[model samples]
Target: MGISDTSTGILKGLVVIAAVFIVLAGLKTATNILVPFLLSVFIAVICNPLIAKASEYKIPKALSVTLVIVLFLAIALSIAGLVGNSLNELSQQLPQYRTQLNEEFAWVTNKLAEYNIAISSAVLIEYFDPAAAMGLAADMLSGLGGVMANLFLIIITVVFMLFEASSLPKKLHYALDDPEMRLSQIDRFLQSVNHYLAIKTVVSIGTGVAVSLMLWVIGLDFFLLWGVLAFLLNYIPNIGSIIAAVPAMSLAILQLGPAAAGGIGLGYMVINTVMGNMIEPRFMGRGLGLSTLVVFLSLIFWGWLFGTVGMLLSVPLTMIIKIGLESSEEGRWFAIMLSSDDDVEKYHTAK
Candidate 1:
């Protein structure tokens, strides 16, 4: 009987794994449709608080939503303009930078040759094309454009979502048998998400501003562009800061010098370390914790599934899933496993 039970459990686990993969495959296939809707949901969540604050001032719901949408559009357009101007300037300067970079590469090759190491200029240029860095910057900008391509759809969806937000409680009450319990669970989940987003948004903005100021002080071109990139990529965890630094640092090397570039890199390292390690945790508190391994894995999984936008939304999307799991008695164990060690210990003691 024990052996039979063990075999059945193993089979059930395998089936569950297969089902999860199937679902993920479908999600990836439908990313074009899903990405816009998911983005709308996220926007609605962020704007909900503003809407509530507006209500306290006796503002009508439709008018409040209109105000928030207008604010969002203005910010979006300003950022786009900054990025566009940066890209245009960078493209014009690329040829001059490319010449300088080739000279630097030749100098490095000669220095290595003095040390009895033969490095071909062709090989070096092929492997490390200075023009390729600009190309990468352009590609990154293009990826942002792709995300904005669905802007109209996302805005429309967000408007409808905001409209439905006030009616969600009534809908839940009508749909669920145990309305109070489900409502409490949902409230907890949204509160946690809102808290996380608020703190993260503030931190990301600080990071962007800090990075921009540092670059500007160092006399780097496109300071605002890099700052905006930092703001967007900071939404991604683990490697996001590193990715944001690369283009700026590369530019620093070409425009300034190795010594100045090193300083710029050090500044980024300090800023990310101080903010990500010290400041964010104090503000985040205990409830929304996720394991480090899970964060990195989710980044890769979502990036693969939904491309760049997926990578940006990975943490929030994963947190939503984790919170949903925790809201269910049967699934709480899985959620606990995904949480930090401290959270896992707390869960054990509570149980």
Candidate 2:
């Protein structure tokens, strides 16, 4: 290559690196601004059906919004209360758990030693480091003020969003001067988002309840906390079920002995297997056909971008992208690639 061409290439590389860092910095800054509003929008969508139903009875939209907000807040706080109680109980028994955990570690080391493999529980612990874990947790807790402040903002925004939802379309129409087109687009967008959220919520609730009941029957401590965890982590997809199962199994082992732990683990596996393999497929009936790699990468990317909230929002965000692509002819090919064969077959049959 000529010297000029080489210089141009180097310039391009620098530009690309600069662009990447700029984007990352922008995202980190924008996260605080966007997260709360996005959360509010999701909450508003969840309550949309109730708002519409109440409006059919000639209830003013404002009153409907107020009622929905009150009911939602009450339900949220009740669940939170249960979780808080469970956490307090767990804290009181931390010494027991700690003792059990050390014993378990010793047992594992001894078993490995039988094969002539030497392992130090202390060394293993230093490598796996609980102190670091505590430090990270302390940092998160220290940020509680900011987290709560943003959460309060989200709630206020959501309430107003619901209240103004009815008039939003009219305002958009006036601004755009293309009412029908804008309305059609908005309706489809909302429908797609709402449908996905509805399905996810039902699935999460079922998983949480099933897991909680199983733990309770097995005489595990903090059943409510595990249940709430199962419900929340169920939003993560693929890896979420496994993540939710681990702590419950640990608690079972620590409290009910090895046999109970094994049984609880087996039961959890069965529940997840049945639901993930059979029930979810029957209800969802083929996904929008996102590539498995794409789905996983998006999970990681979005999780990094927004933390736990991003992970919870991952699938919906991916679905939104899929819908947008499918809307245009050029992008239809991408949507097709994302679909499973069964979904394609079903869609064809329906057509």
Which tens-of-lDDT digit does each residue in 43-63 have in candidate 1?
999899899899999999999
Query: What lDDT score goes with residue 12 in model 1?
Result: 99
Scored by lDDT, model 2 comes in at 0.72
**Roughly what TM-score does model 2 have, to 2 decimal places?**
0.79
Q: Model 1 reaches what TM-score against the true structure?
A: 0.93
In order, candidate lDDTs are 0.87, 0.72
Per-residue lDDT for 305 in model 2?
84
Off by over 4 Å in 1: 1-7, 109-118
lDDT of 2 by residue, 142-230 (tens): 23224445767878998888878888988988887667766786687687677666766788898888988988887787777778777
CA shift of 233, model 2, Å: 1.0
